[model samples]
Target: MDKTAIKKFAVEARRSLIESIRLKAATLGITADGIQAKLPISTGDVEYYVDEQGGISGHDIVKRQKLVAELKQRARKNDLATAFNDLIEEVAYTWFNRIIAIRFMEVNDYLPSRVRVLSSTENRNIPDILVNVRDVEEALGGFTASEKAIITRAEDTELPKDRDAEYQMLFIKQANALNKNLPYLFETTNDYAELLFTPSYHDGVIQHLITDISEDDFNVAVGGQVEIIGWLYQYYNTEPKNTVISMPKSHKFRDTEIASATQIFTPDWIVKYMVQNSLGKYWIKHLLAVGSLQNESEIAREFNWQYYMPDAKQPDNVQSKIETMDSSLKELEIKQLKMIDPSMGSGHILIYAFDVLMQIYESEGYSRREASESIIKHNLNGLDIDTRAFQLSYFAVMMKARQYNRRALTKITHMNVYDIPGTDDFKLEDFEILLSQLSENSSRLLRHFLQEFTFGNELGSLILEYSSSLTSLREELDALNHNQLSFELIPLLDKVADILNSVELLGQKYQVVITNPPYMGSSRMESHLLKFAKKNYPNSKADLFAMFIERWNKALVSGGYNAMVTMQSWMFLSSFEKMRVNLLGNYTISNLMHMENNVMGIAFGTAVTIVRDYQLPSFIGTYHQIKTADVSGKIPQHLPIADNRFNRTNQANFAKIPG
Candidate 1:
């Protein structure tokens, strides 16, 4: 499959689907004009509708009630466009779900026996409800007349006097049920279930959309789906407020828009570079610690120290430096070493990290199955604010693991990946009430929990305990500690416990942290997000990506590695001088590959910088500046890192600069 062509096709198909939904909505009297009459057209509401308490006013509530009443009146009169718009969202969601299911089944052989069997009638015992009768009969054998009836009932057909509505309802219900069993492929809740139905989109049109992409040519089955969906999401945001009937004018850009507009599908080579330089470098250090290298030449070859240290005149100094560094990693330690991508869109970084970690595990005599499980359970962690991205990332990781362990999907072990906590659920008052119940000493401790939790291994122990427990913290407290104070503090303790579990997945310190963090300027950020950044990342608040560099630094263990491809403006921009100073003060840059413009198929100038999160005062870092004329639109997959094209720079002097 030509990825570019697939991407274009997917985008167009999505737009067509949305346009159809809009036209359908208009026909049913759910036009934008009707909606605007009840609710004022404000762009601020478009951006802040989900923030509820943050932006919604008393007047907004009255308007919402009026809009609901108007919609209800239309429904009573048999006008269904309001409902149709909702169905459009659901249909789009279901379409993506179906694609993911088909691709996953195609790639993995060892599905549950119940799922693999081809029963024509609705099989309650099987979770593969989306697989229609034709699919099952073709894969297995012929279906009986009774089976054909069941299959036809499940499908949307005009031949039976327009059963599209019934088919849509049945399809959504089955999809939701299927989601319940496949936790790896779906989140805990199907948020779109209520809104989704079998779309009015013709079966032939849907089939044509699927056929447009040649799935075999893609590197990963889910990659094309993610790219297309992400692009469509961006396209949806750019549409005129009047064109999209589902959202109010004030709510023009949804949360997913932030991801859709900013997410760039990272090239494979960039992923490799970031992973090998950071994760690979640390493993080499571990090997050197165990005296695995027999001689100087072997050490050079094994460590690829020559790649980073091209100007080293004396092998003895480099070897001596390696000997002095600490690398007390046991085989178990190496297996469990955590790595994360904070802005893990579609899990490209985490997927690549899985490969590197697998190699490390295999070297220590682990079978591919053992390594696959170990990596998912202990090594890889990812977090994305986008729910769609989270779904794709989670699915991609499981698919990769299934390649190694055929029975991986049989037992749906939850991976460490998660969508960041949303504003609706995470409230400050809840924590405040818990804090008020605690004694002064306990209150003080709560204030510094994020920092203190990393030191005493308390977080790890809590995670293990919580993992095995069936009861919530309130129940645990009620059963074990009957004291009034303990009872009052249960809610706070439960929140803290949940935080610890999240920390376990997104470690306080990891062996490696790699990502292409979302790139959005402060001006583009929502007001609340901008305020949060100012308070949390004072120096790097100008750009979200810069803030992530600071965050990755804090998330790394001493001597841990951090690698990222970000805008190069921070390197020379005067506004980022403090950020640069703070970064150099805390970490040692290993190497930097700077590209001026139109590199990586984007117009923006970018740089790939690899650094270790430890202060090595005497360390010298390598720097390469790729001239604008030397590059075309895309960075070559085989770009050399060890060549003499890079200029060696001393860390001390680089750190001395104010800009």
Candidate 2:
């Protein structure tokens, strides 16, 4: 699981990718100034491109046409400089992810075609697909005639004869062919991303990606392949993160910048601790409530959840409140339980939650195959503002499912990981003119729902101001059918309906809300984001991570476990006194681990907490504090040696301190 090599490769690959994609775009007549995709005329059947300024002399006009259309569509959204940079960044990451994904699949023998895309089995220097381009149909399981034509046309004498051009065309077709098998990671409409997939096996990113990194790093039997995706993502953004850090205090952090600057990958042990305590504790309590099991210690040993903290002693009067909480879980089904990691970052927490869920399903007598699909479809849910994280999360979860069910990838399982949708340009008058048929009240609600999502991408899953009204609007839309509406309204109605559907999911309550939310202080926040935080979370608005404490608590069901590893400042800072008071007065700290400086490499001091949604003022909560610094950063291993740091504390006593 050592990521030294992966980290080194990822950072180098990012810089090389941006430079390569920029050079490729320049050749396509696309630059920061403008694009001149069309030439003076088409002499007979063949057409000419601006070449360097934007020219194409290829036989196929469709690829050129598609490339121009995608470029124009992206440019319309922002200034030329930002738009070009964004386009380059987007394509670079898409190709990088595809390269890594293909390598992992090829090494694990998970590719549907059983073809090594990046390198050859017979000759490692050449690509396997290139060697057998015309003879891969049988190997591809079920290749279509059109797919064959695409491969053949890539080698047409009229097209460029260069080896790099040839390899790029074949590689793109290979990635596109994989769309049917892995539609989540390999999208069809992202042809713009395809337009810039320039790196090849002969040189550039792919060269080092394969030769520099060991094959064992990608093999599932080696036990760290999937987790490598997370490390790669974190490392790839190293430059952006550094840029953000060096910016002046006056600089406003945009949505995209906010993501890169604040994201810190949680250690594996912390993820396990959060999931085992919340989900594991829930299942154990359920077993006890229903009379299926008695002692949780025995089950904890059997499950090997080393981080599952046993429930601490509670006062006599408060014991019944605990009983009442467990009473509702006596007959709940395994599929009915739900957990959400709101800031889901690469989905490390959700993936561990997936494994714990499988164990729970196994204990309930459900087969591994059945549990795999159910855990993915029902139990595990994730959300992140970054599309890259969402893609990796979806792929990682599906890969995990594939381990249990051989046909999992081919089954079209609807993954729950979502990229927070951003607001797009649209006139309210368009909705009004089209939706004149609907009731005025319903129309108004839909309009406001759209307005609420204006900063959905910037604010992310914390945008909960209009959930109740959005729910009402969803109900209204659900009652109406498209057949009853005019054709123009039908399109608007569909868009509105999809927005409502997404918001409904984002707004749903969960039994466990576990995540390592973004950590940006109010001082560094963008103007709009800081304003929103002050308006929404007036008490916990000093830092992004602390604000999430209130935001996610709202999403948690009463008595549900809301676990997180955040900065320990809120517990003792005078500036956060109001937030601390609100937290202590309202919720019960079921468990807390105060890991001070140097623990887990978070120098600012960190705390892991499992806060029950409702208060048990008299309850004695479990607490673990690490006083001495440990550069090794092995939390679970160091926990035992820090035994003297363990103690029990009643959160209610915190209010007694003098102001």
- Which candidate gets the maximum TM-score versus the true structure? 2
Q: Model 2, which residues run further than 4 Å from truth?
A: 37-54, 57-77, 132-135, 138-166, 424-442, 465-498, 627-638, 641-644
lDDT of 2 by residue, 352-374 (tens): 88889999999889998889988
Worst 10 residues of 2 by lDDT: 51-60
Clashes of each: 8, 8
Q: Local error of candidate 2 at 53, Å? A: 9.4
Pairs in clash, predicted candidate 2? 29-53, 29-54, 49-55, 49-56, 50-54, 50-55, 51-54, 51-55
Return the TM-score for candidate 1, rounded to 2 decimals: 0.70
Q: How does candidate 2 score on lDDT?
A: 0.77
Q: For model 2, what is the error of residue 238's alpha carbon versus the real structure, in angstroms, after optimal superposition?
A: 0.5
Question: How does residue 600 of candidate 2 score in lDDT?
Answer: 63
Candidate 2, backbone clash total: 8
Model 1 per-residue lDDT tens digits across residues 472-567: 332433354426545435545654654544544554568888988877667666555665668878888888788878877777777788898999
Residue 306 alpha-carbon offset, candidate 2, angstroms: 1.1
